[model samples]
Target: MAPLKQRLSMKIAFITPCNAIAGGLFVVYRHAHYLQSIGHDVRIIFADGSQGRQVTWYPNFSVPVSLLVEEAAAPTEYDAVIATWWETYYDMFHLNARTYLYFCQSDERRFYEKGLDSPALLVERTYCDPRVRVITEAKWIQRMFQNDFGVEAGYAPNGVDLSRFHPEVAPLAPRGPRVRVLVEGPGGVPFKRVDLAFRVTARVPDIEVWFVSGDGVCESHWQAARVFKKVKFEDMTPSYASCDIIVKLSTVEGVFGPPLEMFACGGTAVVSNVSGYDEYIVDGQNALVVAMDDEEGAVDALSRLVSDAGLRQRLSAAALQTARAWDWDQQTPIFAKVLAGFCERPIPMPRTARLDYLLLNRLRRLESAVSQLDPVHMALVRSRSREISASE
Candidate 1:
């Protein structure tokens, strides 16, 4: 690779859903910041037309911003336009760019039921589209795309922001006898499985459970001693430092960051062996890893961490060592290189066939809806509605 100073600067645009406080959006902003730091012209284009909106949740995220509303006049040309989410892929059609890329953060198709949700097919189409270049944050996602979808993708692991999440922040609060356990992710999202985390943590005796939700929702059934909602990105370090262990039982992820963040805050984690945990988590080494949906195993692991002080000390020590190695400065350059390489290649022609798939999916949904209705009752209702309209 050439030196940063010697390389030609490329104009890059990242298409995002909104300037929301999400883990995925944070990653996008981090890459944009790094690329801009290296003398490249970078901007984030919000598809929802949130013009002049800055990401206030994340500290010091000062990348350039633009609006990319559909049917409006297209923005100026760029060397590369990267879609950060599935819905943003359609927005790429209206943009002027030399190269289009999809930043696959996760197998988003798994977020919804296949048959019931119509958008699953649309999300799947973005991965299979041949024209769009693909880059992912997890090796597992790269392999899954290769084996499952036959689309090879570049890989870059997400890095922790060490300045905010580190061991030297502050001392733990004065909880003399009770062990404080933290559970992250929104409770309303099914894939996060916050309910399972609550259930397993409740089995342990005399432990204080804290729930931190991005969506500010806490289910009534959850026995949370304290709930922190929509915490700013910079303000989360104290929460992690105060807890001894974080229980993350997410069913799907593309290199999840909370476990890594917790590790940086001088704490251990009990995580499910989800898709991305193997990237950093070592079972019984740095953090305890249980099988997915293994309620009993998760309960036992949390209980062991609460009761065994020596074990907790060993895991937290090893976890801190792991976190120190994955700084943002080190990881963002790999993603920057991937983007630069794509910009150097020949621009492939846009695939118009995706529009055909979109139309067909909409028709299929309409057909399914019509098939569920009674034809004779529908005819009468339509005739009566027409008569009412004619009278008016």
Candidate 2:
């Protein structure tokens, strides 16, 4: 098939939450940059003032909130309106043009007028508009919408920063038995299942757990659990380089970025069998895949890595190869094709008509059941639930 192309003059506006900028922001920013690189006029608008010019490596343009008065007031003039999250979904919902949802994170109900507080209803009722086209980071999310939430959906997987995160580009080290495993991102997220790392550490006295959850490991959780915590994103790679295996055990996920980074860093990974992980890595080949219900599985996988250097090397090599294949340059075209075609095509409505109600209730129940979770945990579940609900 011929590659899709947009007219050079088409302008695209990407609306996202704020400047604190997490994973979803990073993905959207990269998408905007790639869009601009291919000659489309793209700009990003956030709640805060301005995020300023895009760095070449982190190429995404950010403008201040001042532009929104006019832009949001008459959004129909733009070729397309792209909402990066649920809040942005609301903004695009209010607009007058073809609307597209870049449902990056799993937080779908936040866009609703009432949020996911209602379990009895299939939708927020107020946010039930189904006219917009939806795009997400994984087929699992797509299926969620189609099967549960009943929303029209398509899949556009998140891409790695291959230029920065590559096996070839990362610094190499001498062969060693000391493994340096990292659990990256905002940390402390219970869904991230960092506690499982503690289980692994406890089972295998030789392995240590290094964390990136900013608050550092909770004294009680760490003291009782014996897991170590460090709070930094930049420091993640050196830790990855040093580690033989990296593990993430999110109960629910959209698109897992850290494991892909592990691949780029030439580190093998053991991940929970979440929908998002299935999109990228094949079990036992690229990375170890453990069932979510199997709490000991994570510990066992990590222990095996600690005891077997040859297995780690072999898996790491396969992971690096997998990571190379997932480069953004190659994946962006899929998004480009979908986005450009989105301008002309109608969204594919979800097949399971009951999905909308089922997913809406699932989201509500999940959120209610896990409200006591910490910010990181709550955010992770909320994000994943919303993704599932919104896709439906």
Candidate 3:
């Protein structure tokens, strides 16, 4: 007899801006894919319609998908309706559903757009809207929403597709005599600090740096390196596999996906000492950590990694250990539980959750202030960061 898969009691639909090559969008697909695989009737509705389902990860995705051809295409009701981005909320709020969820991946309030109160603030307010239950991906993001915005959101980290990024790709893969470095660019996103990453690439000698983005930042700058447009999701592992190092120096990130993706592909990452992944990364153990503004630190880490192949191997192996626990198989059920809780009502979070939020949130604020201070002010603040953390 065939075993039946556990299915949701009713249908669920996720509304995405488009099926584009983006980390957040990929996370959405994973959520929908997992739900569909478990016998749930999940659908991906295109909010942008014009994106027209052009390029999916492969020939086809796991679940049935539809497009919002007109205003009528919007569903009158569902088991749940998830808005993948904040802008989608304006439309989603009007739609009928048993439950509404904001699948928040970052602090959308930080994201800029023009508005009467600033477009970013308007997005921030959506979290406070009683109609939408908020689900955030990273702990740092949970802290941000809870402490700053007073929204007690659910936390569900995005899981890597480990089968596609198998360890087998790492063993004796083809390599050239020269080293390869990879950098990601969203072009104008301030905190992503793509420009800093490109600068580090330029400083390194005798290595090829590849710029990967659709932002066309390379069209205006960093003309020396090759630009590889974002490939299908299935191809991403191989792309990371071909690289010796992944360097990201984003000033603010709840959690960046590229580093974890590179780790799974048997590569080492040199990343910024940001809040979110501080839980997963130990400076010299799994991956190297560089401060956001430390130009010398960034240069030295890359230069050293290029010169030391053994260090890369050790880091890669340890990183795989870190990656194993975060795979989709582990995170999926936890995600399902969060969704299931909302099916009834907002689950009561432990009292400790609030304390953790205030502490981490304030520390992040202090950290950001120190990062932006003049060298003299920063030196004093660093002296007090530990003290503040203890006293609070």
Candidate 4:
């Protein structure tokens, strides 16, 4: 690979599952935007066909986007086609590209029950594909790929957009006598463990619990004092600044961003010892780190932050320092260099992988058609399929 200063502009395509307001997808879009700014011909391919639809959540997200159909039929070829999610991996083989890449944001297999779902197995299989070069957002994920799958994955840590989430941003709500504790993450996602954050915070007295969800849905049982649903990305700083502390408990993560964003907004955090928190979170130093699924421990940590004003102030100050070190301008160039290196060595997709994708695509389309015809029968079939998968 040549030096960064000597690298020329190369055409790149990032295949995304959808244009949803997801943290992972936002990272992908940010990468595309960064590459475009540096003179690379970059475009985002929406596998779900949500092309030309504006992502209203992200401010000034002006990266070019196209549907998978358009890319598959286009005359110009991409220097590298990267898969941003597991489902989009299958679509990579269909596009015209010199080299293929898989940007594993998380251990996606952990999203499902082990040995009880075919999707988990399929996700695992993508890691084993020899054609696609793997890159990840977390160091632990890079290590997991090497130790478990014997694949050398590149690592590029996610960064906080300091310009948007900074201490200078005014709080959305006025500070009062009661402490405001923020709980972030989608409500319904099981791995996110948002319910646990709400449950633990509820045990602490005299602290207002605020919930912010990228997905618009918040369950009635969560009982949050205030809910900010689907907030614009650039507009999230005020929400974070309004709260004193944020409690984010997740079972799986890829260098999660909300806590760091909270840190950038001059707020402390209470997070679980999930895989990626170790990247920056220091227990009792910058943020309170509790064990996963330990409800009592989380409650204790939240209470400590709420009652001990000195501790909150000390931790928030330290957190701001940590956030300062993780700027987007510093981290995004690492990924661009990875892409430049990948384009230097092109690998042809194997015939077997191409055939496998064709067969799997046909089966999935048939399954989708059947589910549309009889929803009840398909539900029963999925239940039985889970049973068989478990047995296998």
Candidate 5:
């Protein structure tokens, strides 16, 4: 008889809050996709706070504690649970698995002046679980978490989706004047510092600002300026495709998503010197790095890119090269190692024929249950989640 083949040994689950919106959940999505590519049975557990079927919206709001207990009674028998954010960390704590928390930012700073007790401390004490605090860039913030908060941290800087954002590609339609700049929003939560965009636009009237607004922002902000509201997430690349430059100056950020996305698009990126900006963006190379004090720096960088097409061409080329290096294919392996390390099993188990059938049927049922809700109700729930988070 032939020797029995070695069986693969573990299941890994990622727990996210509600939905994959504009922040850490996006990172979770990228990790899940990449982890799947590498032969891990990585499934996302969307606890009550999120829209479960919509993998796009992650880590929503927590379900009632009693409901969560009943829902997760069996706990899916995973080899490990990786919690991507604080709310998910709480969920993972209650689950029956070796748990790890991927803390993205300083909880103190994240909840500063917001009046909630320190979530990191609460989770640490209540769960008493092993955690691997992860940070984007911002060495200063990292130090605070370690030295001040007394938590050891790890660094796995976030990356961009390179295929969706490449400089050689052009927008399908005519983007007027070819002087496009990417700005996130002029309204919505004040955290993004949309006012800064308005001020910068006024300062640099020569350059056209392209605004990308999320669901709740008012249309008037766009009417007063060049704006693109409700752009499909997949089609957002076109905004980058048409742009000559990308400018985002936010008050707070984990990894500064737009600048990285723009850099991947091969456009010159003029980003504020904020938390996590310095991790990859180098001054005078790949992209232009500006100081927060000097909003005029945005104009100067744009003016330079506009006048020197050759320089623009070179930066664009370098930017794409840099972006390609940071693609999911490259970064995911490191992410996988960190995830796999948290679990007891050395190798991920292959899905059995029965397991595949069960997953398919289960996902179908979840989809049906979620599909019952109307689009407007779904939006309302999501908006409510944002308000709760903001208040917290």
Candidate 6:
């Protein structure tokens, strides 16, 4: 592709974690993609090389990914090498890049335990590091890093692929007089609160509820709803299209993506009244926000949205407007300007880093091999095995 603008083109690399269908890594990938599209030299290298999982191109994304194959892969000479995760902060730290940046997708401290290997302090150190320019996806995260840690940070929110996930492509189907309700990440992973969804579902027996998750997040609660496992990224249009009300319960997040995807595909989002969603989800306007612990309120909100067609259509229209604002076409130039400020650095990669890269590459291969099993089916197998063991 020819360079769009006649200026400020530079080499850039994103030190991303795992080649999974994850949100944070995708944001980094999409950023790299946008920079490349605008005629900049861009590459996405896996952090530790160990997480260079098997699949480079998943249906969820369309970016060409690469690994730190050689010690020379990450030469300090690159214009900028942005780190996508906390662990990779150390990777970017050791690299001899001219300009170093950290992509903060969320407040990672939420993932750590008090005394575990993932200590909050370790994650906090990356945020507080003076050498790295911190750019966060959420304003709350930017404020947290600056206010609590006394660090400088900038905010850059995520955008949806409007062309790919729009209402026309995934048309809403006739629900045959029954309100089709959709709940994401069922009952496991404490934050998703699928269990609470089950409670709400029980209250609204008249409506039809469907659950979706790649992992066994809804294993125990599978019987509570019509569950679909490992729904491929491309295949989710129908899921979003058919549902009248989508209730996504998250204890914490960084502007959750699925709700936006649903919104883009003509579905109304009934989300938790938490930091991640409150920024964009204006209650009664675009989305219905339920209090974190208010299961009854969640039920009532779902009932109100499903039963009222005008309310659902109006909210979805406003939601589409919100989604349109965050489209990559609009945000790409803004992101380019932010990185342009730091690409002046030029350095050389150390030969010693090769050893670490090779080891991680080997481990990543092993992880890739093991992770090939369908996560949900594997969870089922493990559950059955345990039951057999107990019976024996």
lDDT of 1 by residue, 1-392 (tens): 77765798888889998767789998998998888988889988887764356778877878888777632285477788889988787666566778889999998988877773346766776777556788999888898888888876888779999988898887446535788999999778888999999999989998998889988989888998888899888888888988889999999888889999999998899999999899999988899999898999999999999999999999999999999999987899999887777777845654454444334434444545664577765455444433432332
For all candidates, the clash counts are: 0, 15, 0, 0, 13, 9
Deviation (Å) of 325 in candidate 1: 1.4
Overlapping backbone residue pairs in candidate 3 total 0
What TM-score do all the candidates reach, one by one?
0.88, 0.73, 0.79, 0.92, 0.72, 0.79
Winner on lDDT (5 vs 6): 6
Task: Give Cα-based local distance difference scores for all models.
Answer: 0.82, 0.63, 0.70, 0.84, 0.58, 0.69
Q: Sorted on TM-score, highest at the top, how do the candidates line up? A: 4, 1, 6, 3, 2, 5
lDDT of 2 by residue, 1-392 (tens): 44445355457788766554355666877777777778787777663346543322233344322344446566355677777755455444444444444454564443234534443233233134465666777886777677765776767777776766755544334335567666654455556666665565556655545655633545355422123344234434565665556777877567878899889888889888876787778887878888985778877887788788888888888888888888888887677667777776645334353345345445555666778866676677667766665564
Model 5: number of backbone collisions: 13
lDDT of 6 by residue, 43-78 (tens): 667654564545543344444556654424544466
The worst-scoring run of ten residues by lDDT in candidate 1 lies at: 383-392
lDDT of 4 at 343: 71
Best by lDDT: 4
lDDT of 5 by residue, 1-392 (tens): 22111225446666666543555666766666665655556666766643444443333322212224343777456566666655555455455554444545433244434333333333333222224334333456556567755665555556776666676567744456656667774367665666666666556656666677765475454423456665555768877777777777766666666777777876777677766777677777878777774667866776787667788778877777777777766665566565444443233322342233233334333434554677665455444433433332
Candidate 1 backbone collisions, by pair = none
lDDT of 3: 0.70
lDDT of 5: 0.58
Best candidate (score: TM-score): 4
Candidate 1 off by > 4 Å: 50-52, 70-72, 171-175, 351-392
Instruction: Say which prediction, candidate 1 or candidate 3, comes out ahead on lDDT.
Output: 1
